[model samples]
Target: MLDPRFLTIPITHRGLHAPGVPENSLAAARAAIEAGYGIECDIQPGPDGEPLVFHDYQLHRLTGAQGFIAATDAATLAGLRLLGTDEPVPTLRQFLDLIAGRVPLLIEIKDQDGACGPNVGTLPARVAEALAGYDGPVAVMSFNPHMIAAFREAAPHVPVGLTTCAFGEDDWARVPPARRDELAAIADYDAVGASFISHDKDDLDNPRVDALRAAGAGILSWTIRSLAEEQAARRIAQNVTFEGYRAAY
Candidate 1:
């Protein structure tokens, strides 16, 4: 269940990246808040191991740049402009400063491959440090179970969410049912410590949702783009993290 202390509509994906808004930019976050939406942004560690807000493994999609985020430093990232704005890539700390206390921040940590990987080793600590004194609801999420586990140990007080795609017995037919149950159990353990479960909207009816909710996890669905998907999510999720749509309800 969602902590009663936190607002119900905590935030939306990429902080309202619409036609005119640049995804993951402070300008976009501010726009979302101004229009009464909380903010959700992606966090990844740069080459220097600083937590920065970016979505893709490479910068080509958002910026015309041509390298992986992990290969660049903050200074270099700050030099290139995001596609739609003069604004450069904003560090997680800079993003927090912009949205501090104004609205809740949902930080989605990207997977940097494996346990003890350079990106995983340093980013979580930096994110925890950046949010040390912020007086608002802060949550961390990741598609990587190991990374989520690390966050649970590193920042216990700050809620964490386990992100999953829509895969089930039918999807994973080759895998043994026992293994699937074990994976689900691991996710439940993280959800028990997490604020919510952020998942792909299409997975609403997946058994994992029932399992996680039964274990007392709150539901948050992501990148909702259409009215039908949005309405479907409302029935299952406590909050919807979106990209194109500004108004959730």
Candidate 2:
């Protein structure tokens, strides 16, 4: 089941990021807690199967580094600084310890297959192990349904969901057209046992989302940047994953 707190709490995308406090950093997580907002973060397995709190598969944009996150070892990742900040990337465990259940957490596990297809790697078990004893209001989701299925098998008790979108060609050049269309229809919702969906704020009007909402599924929206956007997204979504500004609900 989807966690009820995720529905009621206002979520901060990437942990209330701001100047000098980069997204997914421990500093950002602390900022979100101080602001009394739920945290939404992303996770990728380190080189040795440890889960790191990070967003891109690539390291350059956030860290000014040269390679993918899966190629970097735990200690190395801990050493690299976030752009304009001294804060290093944190492990999933460190993030959880800091939060300590003070606020809800939503973790998005980026697709490992690169194609968002069936070739999911060992991330499922690694992530499941990380969440094994950590008590918090947390949910896991991905744009790839296959990853969600694998994760569900590994951690059945955790609420799992899909990160939905209209999958515009320009925006999703990595995901093939066929897969994009296939996922856009949301055909895997039941087969993968998803209890919720964090859809693109622009596409919440889709019939599939409405159908699921009518059937009692949890509906969340992503990247709401302002109070106006949050207000509009609340019409369809029970909550929002937001950034660039505080959501004043």
Best by TM-score: 2
RMSD of 1: 3.6
User: TM-score for all predictions?
Assistant: 0.85, 0.96
lDDT value for candidate 1? 0.73
Give the range where candidate 1 is weakest over 10 consecutive residues by summed lDDT: 1-10
Over the stretch 125-242, how does candidate 2's per-residue lDDT look in tens digits?
7888889988888889999999999999999999999999888888778888988898888888999899999999999899999999999999999989888989999999999999
Off by over 4 Å in 1: 1-7, 114-119, 167-192
Clashing pairs in 2: none
All candidates: CA RMSD in angstroms?
3.6, 1.3
